[model samples]
Every structure is written in C-alpha cells, then in structure tokens.
Target: MRRKARRRRRRRMRRRRRRRRMRRSRMRRKRRRRRMRRKRRRRRLNWRLEKRRRMRSRWQQRKMMRIMKRWRRKRRRRLRKRRRRISMMRRRGEDNEEWENEEEEEKNEEEA
Candidate 1:
C-alpha cells in the first residue's frame, strides 16, 4: 500500500508539470501571432507612404512640365518679334521707329 501511494503522487506531479509546459507554449504561440500582425501592419503603412510619395512626385513633374511649356511659348514669341523688329529697322534705317514699335508691342503684351 505504501508503494502504490508513492507511485500515484509521482504520476500526479508529472501531470502538473506537463500542464504548465503546455500553458507556456500556448502563450508563446499567441505572442508570435501578435508579432506577425504588427509586421504586416508596418508593411501596409510603408506601402501607402510610398504610393503617396509617387503620386506627389508625378504631380510635381506635371506641374513643372506645364510651366516649362508656357515659358517656351513665351520665349518663342519674343524671339519672333525681335527678329521682325530687327528686319524692319534694317529696312527703314530709323532708330525712332524701332523704339516706337517696341512700345506698341508692350501694349499688346500687356493685353495678353
């Protein structure tokens, strides 16, 4: 009888230890899942930020292109007018007429 009671006590102690180990393993698995979720959230946020930066750069590029096109057009018009005025001055041989025409062009430019 004494030997049987001792065996039963040892068996119960082993069962308790196994239960504690199982509980600890379960907690570790829960922590692993939380870490995975956090990593996924960070990746999602980084993707969004990258997308926003791309869109902003594209918008800036488009805006710069528009401004460049406007400047090119204005430059082309001024160059054409300057060429016409120089030709007219060579034909007329008068500095006053060239100056007066330049002033008139300024009025047209202001209207535009």
Candidate 2:
C-alpha cells in the first residue's frame, strides 16, 4: 500500500508540471501574435497619414494658383486704364509746347 501511494503522488506531480509548461508556452505565443498585429496596424496608419498630407498639399497649390491669377488680372486692368489716359493726354498736345491747336480749329468738325 505504501508503494502504490508513492507512485500515485509522483504521477500527479508530473501531470501538474506538464500542464504549467503548456499554459506558459501558449501565453507566450499569444503575446507574440498580438505584438505582430500591432506593428502591422501602425504601418497602415503611417501610410494613411502620408497620403493625407499629399492630398492637402495639392489642394494648397491649386488655391495659390487661383489667387495669383486674380491678382494678375487686376494688375493688367489697371495698366490698361493708365495707358489709355496717357494716350488721350498725348493726343491733346498737353505734353508738347509747340503743337498747340486753336479751339476754333477743333470746333470746325462739330459744325460739319
């Protein structure tokens, strides 16, 4: 009876040790898998952020072009008005001292 009890106790201890080792290996495997999944998700987030930055930069470039075009058009219009005023003044001999025309000579065309 004493030998049978000793054998039974040894068997139970071996079983408990085996179970503990199995649980530890299983937990280690699960932890490694979780870490790998987190790394993949981080890579995906980085790609998405880069894509958003490229899109935003493109939009900013387009907006700047629009503003530049509007400013150029306004400058061109002002230059045209200034040139017209200068031409009219030159045709009236306002800038020339010897090219003066009589007022009665400019009124002959209105009578015709």
Candidate 3:
C-alpha cells in the first residue's frame, strides 16, 4: 500500500506540472497572435495614408499645370493684340515719337 500511494502521488504531480506548462504555452501563443494582428493593422493604415498622399500630390500637380497653361494662353493673346496695334499705328504713318509715347504710357501703367 505504501508503494502504491507513492506512485499515485508522483503521477499526480507530473500531471499538474504538465497542465501548468500547457497553460503557459497557450498564453504565449495568444500574446504572439495579438501582437501580429496589431502590426498588420498598423501596416494597412500606413499604406492607405501613403496612397492618399500620392493621390493628393498628383491632383495638385495637375491643377498647377492647368493654371500655367491658362496663363500662357493669356500672355500669347496679349502679345498678339499689341502686335496688331503696332501694325495699325505704322499703317497710319505714325512716327517713332508716338510709339515711344505709347511705350512710356504702358510702363507707367505697369508700375501703377
């Protein structure tokens, strides 16, 4: 009877140790899984933010290009109008004095 009791006590102790070890391993696995999940979520959010930034930059670039094109077109129109006026003055037999006066008036207007 003494030998039997000793054997039973040893078996119970072994089983309790194994149970504790299994619980510890399960907790470790759960913590590792939670950490992986958090990392994935953060990576996804960062990717989305980067995509939005790129898209916004592209839109701004397009808007600037459009504005520049419009400004160039207006400059071209103004130059054509000036050339037409100069030709008309020359056809009317106007001298360099009138042309110089017009240039001074334009300069004053620009300064104002």
Candidate 4:
C-alpha cells in the first residue's frame, strides 16, 4: 500500500510540471508575436514619413530654381536699360560729374 501511494503521487507531480511548462511556452510565444507586430507597424510609419520628406525637398528645390531664373531675367533687363541711358547721355554731351552723382544716388537707393 505504501509503495502504491508513492507511485501515484509521483505521477500527479509529473503531470502538473508538464502543464506548467506548456503554459509558460504559450505565454512566451504570444509576447514575441505582439512585439514583432508593433515593430512592423513602426517601420511602415517611418517609411511613409521618409517618402513625404523627399517629396517636399524636391518641391522646394524646384521653387528656388524658378525664383533664381526670374531674378536673372530682371537683372538682365535692368542692365540693358542702364546701357541705353548711358549711351544717350553721351550723345547729348551731358556733364560727366552730374551723371556720376546720379549713379551714386541710384546705388544708395538700391542699398536702402
């Protein structure tokens, strides 16, 4: 009777241990799966943000180029006008000192 009781107790303890190990393994698997899912979502969001940033940079570059082109065209027109005015003044035999003073005033106005 004593030997039979001991054998039965050992069998019950072994069964309980097996159940505990199985439960622990299941919990670990669930935790790992959740972590992987979160990581994947974060990566996707980062990729979307990167794409938007690249698009914005491209748009800004194009706008800057357009502005530079317009500025160059205006400068060219202003230079042509100045050359014509100087030539006409020369033909009219205007005083050189007066023209120089006018040029200095124009430069000051532009600086202001």
Instruction: Return the TM-score for each candidate structure.
Output: 0.42, 0.39, 0.42, 0.39
> Could you tally the backbone clashes for each prediction?
0, 0, 0, 0
Point out the higher-scoring one by lDDT: 1 or 3. Answer: 1
Tens-digit lDDT track for model 3 on 1-112? 9999999999999999999999999999999999999999998879745555565577776776677689879866775676678778899888667776766766665564
Model 1 score (lDDT): 0.80
- Per-model lDDT: 0.80, 0.72, 0.79, 0.79
Candidate 2 structure quality by residue, lDDT tens digits, 1-112: 9999999999999999999999999999999999999999998879745555565577776776677689879866765665566567788768753223433433453363
Candidate 1 regions exceeding 4 Å error are 48-112
Candidate 3, 13: how far from true, in Å? 0.4
Q: When superposed on Cα atoms, how far off is each prediction in RMSD? A: 19.8, 25.7, 20.2, 19.0
lDDT of candidate 2 vs native?
Answer: 0.72
Where is model 2 more than 4 Å wrong at Cα? 46-112
Tens digits of per-residue lDDT for model 1 on 7-107?
99999999999999999999999999999999999988797455555655777767766776898799779867876777687778876765677767766
> Which pairs, if any, clash in model 1?
none
> How many angstroms is residue 55 displaced in model 1 relative to the true structure, after the best TM-score fit?
16
